[model samples]
Target: MRMVFRWFGEGNDQVPLQHIKQIPGVEGIVWALHDIPAGEPWPTDRIKEVKQQADQFGFHIDVVESVNIHEDIKLGLPTRDKYIKHYITTIKRLAEVGVKVVCYNFMPVFDWTRTELFEKLGDGSTALFFDNEKIKDIDPMELVEKISSNTSVTMPGWEPERLKSLAKLFEQYEHVTEENLWSNLQYFLEKVIPVAEQHDVKLAIHPDDPPWSVFGLPRIMKNRDDVERLLNLVSNPYNGLTMCSGAFGADPKNNVPDMVNEFIDRIHFAHIRNVKNKGNKSFIETSHRASDGSVDICDVVKAYHENGFTGYARPDHGRHIWDEKCRPGYGLYDRALGIMYLWGIWDSLERSKKVEA
Candidate 1:
């Protein structure tokens, strides 16, 4: 596995590139042009600017966390073709700069949702939490304000501009169902995947954050069968998945290691983090250690090793530790710690293989 760190560019992030480079096994940054709005083609100069900054720190910007798909694309609106053209252009530019994988999602309205950003954990370190009961009761607008209120850096799924049209977005999806979402996603893949293949870049769709429906929004990519169906929708290597342990693990039914072994070839990137599942469709982010969370992170790592996975992977959402105030889930200390945990697993697997041989 090639480990990368998600650096949200200079000024926008508290953790700098130098700090990321100091992490032992991290060789690259998973990045994007955050200031650029979704559906707009990213400028070549801007992409190069990020590349130059990572170069200065001696790190490769090989994976992009997202080139966010517009709601028009997800809703299958008439204007989707224009946004798709812009997306295709962006893909070509990213590939020109040696980006091997582009991690994007097709979830409508919100990219991911949670009732609370800093739910207090037993250990005093806080984590991103989801309360099933509370989510059912709370208004999504209030939740949006809660998530986007304190930070200058844009949260991944809760883009400020998109949330502004919450009422309209919700109304747009009123008639849409799970099947509609799947068809729309397939439409998007058909248009974008060929361009991705031409550019030698794989489009890795991140699974729905909780791997279930929220606020009555239809979520299709929530299980192994969903992932399999998606891969077969386009039937191309460039059309793939960004298999996230924390997202899929929320479901409890998803065996992440087994999925990794099954879908190894289609996995272009991975978000290896852990979550402690609470009963009845609720979970909270936990330390990346296998014992702390529901997902068997060691087995996940070992599966990757056995499969000879050389694809890019990163420590996903982490706890807000050491009083290091930053983005809710994208803090430095815990993620750095998570990386060490992952490295420990990978190293042990390598040694075990040698011993067995």
Candidate 2:
């Protein structure tokens, strides 16, 4: 596995490239054009700028966390073709700078939902938390309010422009069912995946966070069968998955390690973070350690190694430790520590294989 880090660029993130360089095994940055809204084609000049910055630190910008798909594409609106053209343009531009994998999601309105951004843990360190029951009772507006309350840090999925127009966005999806979502996603893949192939860029769809419906929005990328259907739909090696443990682990039955082993061939990117299942479809992001969360992170990491995974991997969503005033899950301390923890497992696996040889 080639380790990567997620950096929000120069001013946007508190964790600097200098700090990320200090991490033992990280080789790249999973990044995006944050200021650009969905549906806009990222300018080639801007892509080059990010490339220059990463090159300065000797980190590859080979993986982009998202090139946010316009809601129109997900809704299959008449204007989708226009937006999809923009998306294709962006993909070609990213490829110019050596980006091999582009990670994105198909969840409507919100990309990922959570009730609290900083839930206090037993160790006094805080982490992103979700309470499923609480979500059902609360209004989507209230949840947005809570998530957006952190004005200093921009939440990944909850872009201000989208949040400001929530009512219209929800109304647009009011008629969209699970099947509709699947159809729309297939339509998107059919259009973009071919272009991605032309550019030699792997289009990796991130699994829906929580791996279930939120706010009654249709969620199709939630499980193993869902992934199976996705691969079959596109039927291209470049059309792949960004298998995230925390997202799938929300459902206790996900069998994350098995997923790593089963879909090893098509998983182009990996987000290896652990989450403690809070019961009844709720989970909280936790330390990458196996004991700290429900996911068997060691087994998951080992599975990746055994499968000969040379693709991009990252230690996703670390807790905010040492009173660090950083992005909730993108903190430097816990994630840097998580990298060492992951490397410890990966290196030991390598040693065992050498001994066997």
Candidate 3:
């Protein structure tokens, strides 16, 4: 497995590219143009600016965490065609910049939701948290305020403009069901996957954050079966999965290592992190160490090694350690630690192979 780090960009992130390059096995950055709104063409000049910056620091800008999908596309609105065309244009530009995989999601309004940004753990470090009972009782708008209150850094899914119309978006999805979401996602894949194939870039869809419905919003990409169905919907190698462990692990039923083994060939990107489930559909992020969390991260890594996975892998969400004032889940200290932990596993596997030979 090839390791990469997630960098938000020059001024937008607290962790700089130099720090990322210092991590032992990290060879690239999983990034995107966050300032640009969804459905807009990613300007070539903007892409070049990022490339130039990464080049200065000696890191590849090949895999993007996301090119955010517009609500119009997910809702299947009349204006979706225009947005999709713009999306196609963006893909073409990304290909020009040597991007190999473009990760995007088809979730309606909110891309991911959490009740608390910093739920303190036993070690005094904090992590992103989701309380199921509280989520059911609280209003999404209130939760939005709680999450976005820290304006120091930009949250991926909860953009200010989108959250402004939380009620309206919810109302729009009144009639939309799980089947509707699946159909809309299929529509999106049909149009874009061909372009992706032509450009030699893979279109990877990130699974829903919690792998379940939230605030009555229909979430289709929730489990392995859902991923299987999605892959078959387009039935092309270009159409792939991001294979996020934290997201899929929230559902106890999802065996991440098994999913990795089954979908190994089609997975182009991976977000490997650990979360400790609290039972009854609740979970909290934890250290990337396998024993600390619900997911068997060791088995997940071994499965990738056994499958000969050479795709990009990055440590997903990490605890806020050392009083690091950074993005909620994307902090430097713990994530850097997570990288070393992963490297330990990879190094061990390589040695064992050498001994056998």
Cα lDDT computed for each candidate against the true fold? 0.91, 0.92, 0.92
RMSD of each: 0.9, 0.8, 0.8
TM-score to native of every candidate shown: 0.98, 0.99, 0.99
List where candidate 3 sits over 4 angstroms from the true fold.
Answer: none
Error of 3 at 340 (Å): 0.5
What tens-digit string does per-residue lDDT give for candidate 3 at 125-244?
Answer: 999999999999998888888887865788888878777888899999999999988888889889999999999999899999988889889999999889999999999999999999
> Which runs in model 2 stand beyond 4 Å of their true positions?
none
Clashes of each: 0, 0, 0
Give the per-residue lDDT of model 2 (tens digit) for 110-162: 88888888898999999999998899999999888878776587778988988
In model 3, the clashing pairs are none
lDDT of 1: 0.91
| Candidate 2, backbone clash total | 0
Tell me the tens digit of each residue's lDDT in model 1 across 1-357: 899999898888999888888899999999998878889999999999999999998889889989999999999999999999999999999988999999999888888888888888989999989999899889988888888776667787777778889999999999999999899889999999998998899999999988999999999989999999999999999999999999999999999999999999999999999999998888899999999999999999989999999999999999998899899899999999999998988888889889999
Q: Which residue segments of model 1 deviate by more than 4 Å?
A: none
